[model samples]
Target: MKFLLPIFAALLLSLTTVNARAAEHGTAEEAIALINKTAAYLIDEGPERTFFEVSNPRGRFTYRDLYVVIYDLQGRIMAHGMTPRLVGLNAMEYRDDDDKQFVREMIERAAKGQTGPVDYKWVHPQTQRLHAKSAYFRQVGLYVITAGIYK
Candidate 1:
């Protein structure tokens, strides 16, 4: 029965692999849907209301896990998600390569009227922990949503 036991274990491993793959696909789909929803809201509400109105509530509700930013065409931060201290702050002053790159990429894509896909390995400012984040940018708009999962 040793041979039978080995075959059964292999089957179990295969099933686990399939389940993991399905879960990943499901997560990607959900991420895409979230970006789309945020984009639609931005389009309908416009930047003024989006940044001033929606941000306050979301920041109040899920303040810790989310960091929202709205930038103008000139790459100036107009609003900050949870941290009000960051409002009117300039990301251009950042010295770190990863942080700068993240900002640059978001602006570049936003200019093209595109929303970037889920970006992983983002770093938190206060905690300095590695984070998995999704960045959504809409062109010439009032807001960008960045959701970070702590690692």
Candidate 2:
């Protein structure tokens, strides 16, 4: 009976921690705000400094599960907050689980000077699982600034 009680306590603690982490995930509004903030930063600081800061995993551009990704007009990744390794790659042909060419779509939208949310499935950085995600983006000059929230 004593062992069962301790097990129950541990289970409760685990659930509590998981819930707390989930609560830390960013919201849709927050994602949009972050993208706007990144756009401003890019304008004020230019790509050199802006990309450096955004690529930093612990930088202000990354909060909770929301991170910034900067893509050039040509669909090349200029900076990435979550995965720095993808910074120099071209994700134009990248597709989600549903075979949606999300990166290409984002580029096309940005090229037309649009700002809004792009819905797609992506692997959550925290959960490492496929989850529905909506990324908010804005075109700043020749670059697209984006931030997303996992649903």
Candidate 3:
């Protein structure tokens, strides 16, 4: 009975640690909310202003492990909240570690007037390691606004 108790305690501790780590990162709901907010901002403030704000590393569009990224129909980066240097770059040919052209897929989905999540592998900014991620995106005018959470 004593051995079983210790095993149960260890299992409980492991579960708690996993939950804590998950809480430290962003969630799917947060990503969707950020995407909606970015889209609304873009519609109201226009692309030039919106893009500048979205590209600001310390902007409101960035929080936790999530950030907004705007792309045109052709997969050109319009703004990137986490990496402003990515702005104005064409990401159509960019691929994940698994050779998945996620940017190109995102462009295709957005062009079809789709609004949902796209699962792929990407380098996590905080960890600097490739991790599974799911980005929620929505098509707004000529651009697609996205925000992702690491899973």
Q: Judging by lDDT against the true structure, name the best candidate.
A: 2
Give Cα distance to truth, residue 11, candidate 3, Å: 16
> On residues 43-108, what C-alpha lDDT tens digit does candidate 2 reach at each position?
999999999999999998998989999999888999999999998999999999999999888889
Relative to the true structure, candidate 3 reaches a TM of 0.85
Model 3 whole-model lDDT (C-alpha atoms): 0.89
Put down candidate 1 lDDT per residue, 57-78, tens digits, no spaces.
3643233344456665556676
lDDT: which is higher, 1 or 3?
3
Tell me the number of clashing residue pairs for each predicted model: 1, 0, 0
Q: After superposition, how far is residue 91 of candidate 2 from its true place, in Å?
A: 0.6
Scored against the true structure, residue 117 in model 2 reaches a CA lDDT of 77
Candidate 3 residue 84 Cα shift, in angstroms, is 0.4
By lDDT, the better pick of 1 and 2 is 2
- Give the Cα error of residue 2 in candidate 3, in Å: 26
Using all chains and alpha carbons, the TM-scores for the candidates as numbered come to 0.53, 0.95, 0.85
